[model samples]
Target: MTYVFNMHDAKTKLSKLVELAESGQRVQIARNGKVVVELNVVAKKSRPLFGEFKPLNIWTSEDFDEPVQEWIDAFAISQSELELQSNKK
Candidate 1:
């Protein structure tokens, strides 16, 4: 079914017009008895929610999460040098 409303009537009853359009009925707004604009219900798209987990097809070694040996050794050396300088002061 098609429902037509004049500009002033459409503005006052906007919500009712939207409801009618969403229910698969044609709705039109007119000016001086000539149709000017139409109202339609846009389909809602599905979206992924925040923090949704999706797995990637990638692999890593068991030690990938561990700190590198060279970095650990450098840090230890820096720490020992700092301690020696503090002891001398």
Candidate 2:
């Protein structure tokens, strides 16, 4: 979800906003309803403790690595929710 706040509100709720941003939400701090700054979760590089799993490269179909439709739908739903939240602001 995207969160919107004015400068004062953003400052006052900095901690809470950070917590939300850490959870993959976008936050926009506005001045007079004009967006000034945005906070978002930064993508982190992931490392396995032991090592990375090697791909077998045995898949036969071109769509083998494609995301399932259900997952795509879920993502779409999530995006829609974020858009809705943005509209509210």
Candidate 3:
């Protein structure tokens, strides 16, 4: 639905008008009984699909799936701390 609002009412009810505009409603703001500005929902820009063509022989490194030793040690310590905290409750 299109909502028409005068300048005074538009200033007071701006938030609600903005919500209505954002939900695809056309909101009109007028001065001296004439429409001055229009608010409407902006359409989102579409993204183009990248790399649709077939790539030749892209291979990942052997250690790609392996966890770092530092992170493993930290994870173990975090688990131990969590267990201690759970036992105290």
Candidate 4:
């Protein structure tokens, strides 16, 4: 649920508002009667770095089979065709 507070009330009760926000409540601070800012609680999760020290391998078997120029020409042709179709519309 969202808790709405005017500017004065929000400033006076800042600690209590923070406590509520930390407990998963959305706090809206309003100037006069209009909402101006919002405070949200974001939960962060821990991630494991299992592959941090893995060796990098750039060369593959396919790289030897196909020339780099062939891939670049194909990509350029497709991009031009896409641009032509978009311009028609």
Candidate 5:
């Protein structure tokens, strides 16, 4: 549920309003019957700054990797095959 308070009332009960908002209540402050501001509780969970770190393997061989040109050629061939099969349907 939300509660609306006029500017003067909100100013006078600022502390109480903060307490209510912190307790998951939504509060709207209005000036001259127009809403000026809204207040609500926003819960935040803190995470660990440093949980885990993995070491890098800099001695990996580049010869075991597939060449980019070969992969691109295989992709083009597979796409052409798919297009041929679709056209035959």
Candidate 6:
């Protein structure tokens, strides 16, 4: 079904018009009695999959998932050592 509404009428019924368009009906808004714009349900986009960056020429190193030494050392320190370091700051 197709629905047409004048500018003022469309403004007051904007939400209803959107609902109609989303339900697969054609909705049009007019200005000065001539149709000028349409309301449509936009097609939803799919989320990109994992490792989809290859098309963009981006690559990761083999060691990207390896444990980082600095992070390991930070986590290995004792709670007292962390408190002493904070006090020194």
Ranking by TM-score: 6, 1, 5, 4, 3, 2
lDDT of 5 by residue, 48-78 (tens): 5784556677796777676789889999999
Clashing pairs in 2: none
**What are the lDDT figures for the candidates, one per model?**
0.95, 0.90, 0.93, 0.91, 0.88, 0.91
Candidate 3 structure quality by residue, lDDT tens digits, 1-89: 88999999999999999999998889999999999999977789776578755778989999999999999999999999999999999
Model 1 C-alpha lDDT per residue in residues 1-89, reported as the tens digit of each score: 89999999998999999999999999999999999999989999878887675967899999998999999999999999999999999
Give candidate 4 misplaced runs (Cα > 4 Å): 45-89
Q: Extract clashing residue pairs from model 3.
A: none
Of 3 and 4, which scores higher on lDDT? 3
Worst 10 residues of 6 by lDDT: 50-59
Q: Write the per-residue lDDT of candidate 4 for residues 1-89, one digit (tens) a residue.
A: 99999999998999999999999889999997999999977788777589866688777785576668978999999999999999999
Q: Model 6, 45-74: lDDT tens per residue?
A: 988899875566679999999999998887
Model 2 misses residue 36 by how many Å? 1.3
Q: Candidate 6, overall lDDT? A: 0.91
Error of 6 at 40 (Å): 1.9
**Candidate achieving the largest TM-score:** 6
TM-score-best of 1 and 6: 6
- Give me candidate 2's TM-score against the actual structure: 0.46
lDDT of 3 at 79: 100
Question: Which residues of candidate 1, in runs, are more than 4 Å off?
Answer: 49-89
Better candidate by TM-score, 3 or 6: 6
User: Among all windows of ten consecutive residues in candidate 2, which has the lowest summed lDDT?
Assistant: 50-59
Candidate 3: TM-score?
0.48
Error of 2 at 49 (Å): 8.0
Candidate 6's displacement at residue 65, Å, is 23
**Backbone clash count, each prediction separately:** 0, 0, 0, 0, 0, 0
> On TM-score, who's better, 3 or 5?
5
